[model samples]
Target: MEAPPVIAVVGPTGSGKSDLAVSLALELDGEVINADSMQFYRGMDIGTAKITEAERRGVPHHLLDILDVTEEASVSDFQQQARALIADIHGRGKRAILAGGSGLYVRAALDVLEFPGTDPQIRRRLEAELEAAGPAPLRQRLEAVDPVSAGRLGDARRIIRALEVFELTGRTFSSFMPAREYYQPAVQIGLDVDRELLRERLARRVHAMVDRGLLEEARRLDAAGLRKGRTAPRALGYAQFLKVLDGTASVAEAAEETVVATRQFARRQLTWFRADPRVSWLDWQDPGLVARATGLCRTVPVQPLA
Candidate 1:
């Protein structure tokens, strides 16, 4: 029998991607592989909205809580791990459901994306420069050599990475960008959301997170070295709540800030996934959303892998 095509449920945070992934997994005899970078860390449950054990309804989930709060989540490493899990699931005659909203990580798992090589020495030097002089100098330098990447990249870490790639390969980072080609037989289902409703939903969700002890979780992880983590510390709710711990922000203030940041992040997520023409979008709130998504999975023909 032919293996089932991988089904990826994707969208902005709070769009109900996780719930739909579980429903599809149950209906299709599939297991889920999380692609959300923030969900990689252990002890980040409340803020990340990680699906609880009971919520999973006995369907197996992979790649959740696989890293300590202090460990960095690497896209290349995730590419290897997610791909291996997909192959293993298929070999066992089960479908592979890739689920999450992390755009680059999703592309890494299913798209023909090539990650640039990194030199630690060069990276460290660049990081040091970033720390000493801030992003202004680094952004200026990147704009000089790789204006496309410079214009696109806004974070310090990515800017440093682009510079490192340039130094190592003597090629602009943009030159290494992959076309929207899938690495395997797969289907991407995006949850289409109403921007206004999602904004309100995100605000309520952030408040609910706070009521559910997001501050306590953040404090626990902070003591567990979340502050030392390169990526984990920057997560929306945790970052805002961490400020509450430091006496710089109140619980209400943190919750409000988190809501704003989350809404902004969701907009960016929509932009990223919408740019990829291959994704089939479905209304997140439709009564037959699961049925529609499952039909998409069954009907889409998977091309032969090259």
Candidate 2:
């Protein structure tokens, strides 16, 4: 019997990951399984760049809009859901295309990572430290305690998590973290675009979001009390727009800030994906990118054990 195949399309935000995934799904008869952290929320469409039904081009998407914005979703949760979805897709003799820019989420779904079970006391202390000392001090402390894990996780939230694990287990977080062994047979395709072009695209996308009632969406989410320090709330536009809602920033200023923050995020995402040896990179502007990606997908030998 042949083993199942999975395709993963990963890149920085505004790197055309969605479009590529959609096109590939249409071409390959695949369903998109979202790997973005924020796009999992039901009410976070505009800010998370979630694909609407209309935008799916008749291709099915899974693990999107499944959680309320206020609900806390973890990497383990995502991995479990994604693995189930992939199995279902394979059982149906269809393709599963994993797509998004969230590096940790994508990594969790692809690599067999054993997340330490949660500890409320550790979490409470870490949250208190984050509240009182801000992310920098917590990040510095994580770096001091677990430089390897800290270096792997440059994002503030991820750094905090490393510290939380260390605090609870009294061991380096890296010691508990799993290696990057493939969990399934997958064709990992990374989208790469010019930095300047990507920045311009991000700015344009943010402006488009503003025109698409992003402020109203943000207001509704805020009213739901979902704009707190939750992971979803910290997504690119929501946090910046919250400043506008609280009168700390003008709408125009918030929009600009969102663009800047998203650009930085895209940079970080590129760095993360670039560092991964598993992904086969492709130039986003290549006229034959789709053909190349599809060809690579077809040629990847399926691993029975995976």
Candidate 3:
């Protein structure tokens, strides 16, 4: 049997990944499976830049708005769900279009990384250390134990989680990284855009999110106890708005901060995807982006099923 073709549309935020995915899906009889981290939350529409019903253009989308604001969604969780969704879509004779800006989630799904189960004792000790000494001490500990993993994971929460896994399982989290060869037959299409244009679009998108009641969404998450420092709450807009809500920053200050953070995040995403040789980078702003992507899709070499 031939393996189903999977096309992944990936890039930094504000790079028009979703638009490309929607266009490709419409033209190719594809169903989109979201690979974004925050787009999973049920009520995080505006901040996540989630595709509206009209934007979907009747193309089926999976994995968006599937989780609650209070819940934490892991890369492993996404991998399982996305694989299942893609298989189902293929079974129905449709292509699977994986799309989003979350590099880790995308890597996990495509590479089929083996994530270790959580250990409560290790988690408790880490929690206690965080309570007593804050993230710096735990970060220092992780740096000492696993410098490579420490260097790769800049986010404090991710670093600590890696440390927790190491402390509990007595193995490096990096050791569990799946080989690149594990991915099923796939084509990775990365959206590229001008930096200035992306930044301007990000600023405008942030304001549009505010106009669409992002503040109200933040308030709702705050009411659900998803304040600063929590994993689920540390997502871009929510974390910045929480600072505003707590009076540590003005609304204007929060908006500025959010834009800066999101731009930095976009840069990080670009770095991540660039490191992968498999991705075929495309100019997202190109007038013929759809045609180019469609051409690539049609020409992708098929592979034998496992």
The C-alpha TM-scores of every prediction are 0.97, 0.91, 0.93
Please identify model 2 stretches exceeding 4 Å from their true place. Answer: 129-145, 150-160, 304-306
lDDT of 1 at 136: 97
TM-score-wise, the better of 1 and 2 is 1
How does model 2 fare in lDDT?
0.85
Query: Distance from true position, residue 20, model 1, in Å?
Result: 0.5
Encode model 2's per-residue lDDT on 127-188: one tens digit a residue.
88888978888878888999888777776667777887887778888986566788777878
lDDT of 2 at 41: 87
Error of 3 at 277 (Å): 1.0
Winner by lDDT between candidate 2 and candidate 1: 1
Score candidate 1 by lDDT. 0.91
Q: Quantify all predictions' global Cα lDDT against the true fold.
A: 0.91, 0.85, 0.83
Ordered by TM-score, highest first, the candidates read 1, 3, 2
Candidate 1 Cα outliers beyond 4 Å, as residue runs:
302-306
Taking the tens digit of each residue's C-alpha lDDT, what string does model 3 give over 47-108?
78899999999999999988777777878888899888877787777889999988878877
Question: How many pairs collide in each candidate, listed in order?
Answer: 0, 0, 0
lDDT for 278 in candidate 3 is: 87
